[model samples]
Target: MRRGRRKFDDDEADFVKRGRIEPALSEDPDLPETGDRWSTWDNALHGPDPLPEWVRTEHGAVDTELGMLKTGKEADVYLVRRAVPDTDKVSLLAAKRYRDGDHRLFHRDAGYLEGRRVRRSREMRAMTNRTAFGKELIAGQWAAAEFDALSRLWRVGQEGGTISVPYPVQLIGTELMLEFIGDHKTGEAAPRLAAVRTDREGLEDLWRQMTEALSVLARTQIAHGDLSPYNTLVHEGRLVIIDMPQIVDLIANPQGAEFMARDVRNVANWFTARGLRVDQDELIERLSYEAGLL
Candidate 1:
């Protein structure tokens, strides 16, 4: 559970401090004296407004990294706590920092980049050639895409209740801060759908939720290009989708239908294997129609 004041051991404190971006001066004049770094809200691109009250937007707010929550090929999510010193105001954010071109592997990027475009022909050529600059651009694109996708989906889900996504908090270069979907008090993340175990009734309910989420995405003309049980989380019996950096524009991408179908099959097969009667073909057809493909 969250304490009024959390203390970090020597090792933990050192780890957190090492991750901080220091200022030019020995003792940075710009940063607050207490936390690791000042609130980045003043410099970064912000999330959709009517912002949540929990978000610490004030300049007095500072961010401190608690620990890493997840690691992946493209990015690593760290548990970041943003708070106003001497105040009770605090927000827990999952800060997903994308690896730079030199460090990141681009094996899964080609297909997803088909429909996405950059204005400059030079940039496009560089991305196509996988130049050093191009890889950096691609990395930034992934972060921006996911942030934009989550922002749009969060608003839509709030209106319709068919799907759920973390509220995007902010994006700075390749670092995206999102609403941490877990026990805020304990800083423990919810289990992925792949790790969830449930009774028959619960399984059926989750399946229904999954279908509704897919339907909403189809109607919105987007495909979660890499959706799977591993990328989906269940919190308090609610299904929340995550990891959409490769989200496909259903009408724009040439293989959009294939991607959507593949997504459906991936989850449907899992459900069927667990003794659920999933009509994959039927679901696919319905989604295709909803996406205006039929």
Candidate 2:
């Protein structure tokens, strides 16, 4: 019988040398190229993206990349599972690896990075020039930024306000490992709210939940900067916000009010389109007050 290649394997050489390549594993997960430039998306070899490593080395516990869930301008999200072959210790994790290398396609980085400060002039110049090192720096910066923001918000939610977020596991350079927010046993990812066709009941519930969660963000003096239905997940009737790399600084950024308004409007518009009666003006006003933007 003929066999096929090991799909989605991290590195070809390592697997081949160690006999880790499975010849019969043909049904590997699917990951399509998202046309993200080197220096910003995932799987750009000889690029700035950092490689993934097995943090824990157990005799039977092996980590596998199921497939890519989504790809954005800055990174890609892939489903990874770590489980011991014979035991019950198992977990599914979302691995978000930022892209790097070559000329990037997106140019709106500076807008989001307005309040962000770079320490060294050399690095700043390099970043402005979009040099290889600069792109790498940007990748790390975005990854670290998301990791930090998620950690802060995740803790706050855990402590009290109950923010729905994927638990940030650990980070290695431009790759962040997050707790998967779907079926643990089946490994089915929860669809984004944008993909769901909802009834009035579902819309109302989502609106309520989203408002509460955003209120926590406003109260904490932070804005989701790029909040939309696409970046949010509704799983088991709870809305979980994802993709935090662009989280705006409510107090630090000069355009905080504008960003906050945009965020509020995006959510409000979606809810209204779904036949939910939402007060955009009043909602923005209230959120601005909570965000200390007034």
Candidate 3:
């Protein structure tokens, strides 16, 4: 019996094992066609331009289960998704569609756009003239400026390790696709810090994060002109900055320092109301010094 051990051929063993394994299917039955389900919303009320056919085609396949997360006068944020190829995966993304013809609010302020290189005085005159073509060009530039500032922030913050930004994917006209900073599976919108109450310890952390964000802005030569609780997101004990269409360039704008001071003051005062002690002037000086702007 000890001498009766038998050797199995590799091909025969593989054949026997293959019978137990199921053959691969041609297509995934569980998978659905891209953009099969369509959901519609009122663009006027939502601030998103009507989703273009190509955008829908490229990004509409994932469970875009449309939900209005936040609506402002300028734009609205929609929670969306796009399916990843070759894997049964869906990623949460934010679709911010700026309202068309709504550039009046930001574009009307010539001071904000000052010092930036304009192609021509004629173009600037056209923008100032408010002609149909001029208005459209201004709107396009405004949108492009937001996209540019956001891209800079995303890159600089990540590189400096001072903050985190959702990965920016594309900017199609007034529609911007960004990585959603919330948990979509649970269907919970990321709570803006302004909308939530925090304890003393949490408030201190928030204050620190805000100051750190300011330092990052200064380091990158940009100022978040509209920094406030509403634009700050509290996710997993971290603060994420958003809504930067009004971000200002420090080098180009003479009022950049004032804007930076105001930003610091605004965040500091908000935390002060919550029982956190912060000195606006000191914070501003520190930030300016750290940024080498002082």
* Stronger candidate by lDDT (1 vs 2): 1
Each model's Cα RMSD: 7.9, 11.1, 20.0
Query: What lDDT tens digits, residue by residue, belong to model 2 across residues 116-227?
Result: 7799999998878878998888878888888878877877777785578877766767778787887776666777777778788888888888888888989988888888
Model 2 lDDT, full chain set? 0.70
User: Per-residue CA lDDT of candidate 1, range 227-267, in tens?
Assistant: 88878889999999999999999999999999999999989
User: lDDT by residue for model 3 over 1-294, one digit each (tens)?
Assistant: 479533322101111011111111113345456532332221211222333232333332444335555555566566665654455555666766666563433443466666666778888787777777776665666567777776777776656767766556566666666667776676465677776687998888878877888888888888887777767778888888887776788878988888888888777877988888888988888877766677
Total clashing residue pairs per candidate?
A: 0, 8, 0
* Reference-based lDDT, each prediction: 0.85, 0.70, 0.64
**Candidate number with greatest lDDT:** 1
Residue clash pairs of candidate 2: 38-100, 38-101, 39-99, 39-100, 39-101, 40-99, 40-100, 41-99
